[model samples]
Target: MTAPASSAPPLPDPAPYQGAPERHPRRPRHPLDTATDPEAVELTAPVFGPADVDALDADLTRQHSGEPLGERLTVTGRVLDRAGRPVRGQLVEIWQANASGRYAHRRDRNPAPLDPHFTGVGRCLTDGDGRYAFTTVKPGAYPLPGAGAWRPAHIHFSFFGTALTQRLVTQMYFPGDPLLPYDPVLAAVPDPAARRRLIAAYDHQLSLAGGALGYRWDVVLGGPAATWAEEGRR
Candidate 1:
């Protein structure tokens, strides 16, 4: 059976969670931020509905003749509602920096080298089983603007769910990355377990021997323990 949508609100907004007083981006300390914004709470969000995202879009490997840098990876996951049933027809889009910790975008001034073939972006829709997968190269850790600041390897994901409240934007990290504890962005998430959800577990069973390694990351929407999402209020 299809998962039933939860009436409960999603996990707390990442803005507020990571809005420590000294945060560089400076999360608003306004009293109003604690509560849900009236607009987000009231607006009638539009549903994009089911789409046919090409499998080609999901593969970041072999974008060019030579293989992309870093280890080849297969990220597979399922979309489930709080009720624990599969949420089919959901859209999941991912973008990540190249193995050298540089994004393909022009604004990224990181010293890392960008792979000519690695576009660093992909999108796909969940099947009837609510499963989605992406074939890409593992991102690299990079230094930030601040002194000694560095981000761990991670993939940014945006889930376009059935409703505005269901829509979510979050980052996925690799398992056993020693930097997880120190990364400011990931640290913003308050719940220990919720933070764990962002880390994709190593899955040898799904690995394609002599090919890309595999990892599994399940996403639960609108549940008591939902994934951390972007702050829609702003």
Candidate 2:
């Protein structure tokens, strides 16, 4: 007989992450956000099949020719379902500012220096164990246009599930960041516990000797920790 078929149920439809109405003035919800935007009840088809994503999707550090500046970092984590089961072959995309907290986009008005070797974008697929990793520089904090408005160092993440409805985008923050609690963008997330889940924990064991520090952050698309993917973060 052929190898046994898997018995696990398909991942659950993630609960709609609710946000407090009060955040509108400071962080208005998008007009086409999932809450108000309606689409066909049928599961929207996936743009690409699992086969379309490959190993290159996982290693973002080598996109450029030279080494980026600032403290090097190796970020690692797994994608798991609510039951803590590894969800392999998920497409995960990450982009962040350079060590100086300056993005390489033309629209960025920040005066900080930009690293020539750092495109600040990476893609990777979770392996058999549902694990994914990337190497990058520790981004610095940046000041927003408004007075006393400084955004904490963070990396943007977009994870695509098997279907369009399964997708979610959020940001991952560094631990021990004092700016977190004060950021209006982050504050838009109503639940304190859910907010905490957005931060990645430092993992000395995963650190590179005398080099990059390491961080471990696992993501759960559905289940109890489903609240982890807080809203307000694009």
Best by lDDT: 1
Query: Model 2, stretches more than 4 Å misplaced?
Result: 1-59, 208-211, 230-234
lDDT of 2 by residue, 146-191 (tens): 5466889999888877665566788899998877755665766666
- What is the C-alpha local distance difference test score of each model? 0.79, 0.74
- Model 2 accuracy (lDDT, Cα): 0.74
Worst 10 residues of 2 by lDDT: 10-19
Query: What is residue 44's positional error in candidate 1, in angstroms?
Result: 9.9
Q: For model 2, what is the error of residue 118's alpha carbon versus the real structure, in angstroms, after optimal superposition? A: 0.7
TM-score of 2: 0.74
Give Cα distance to truth, residue 181, candidate 1, Å: 1.3
lDDT of 1 by residue, 137-197 (tens): 8999988665465788999998876555456788899987867666777766777788888
Every model's TM-score: 0.76, 0.74
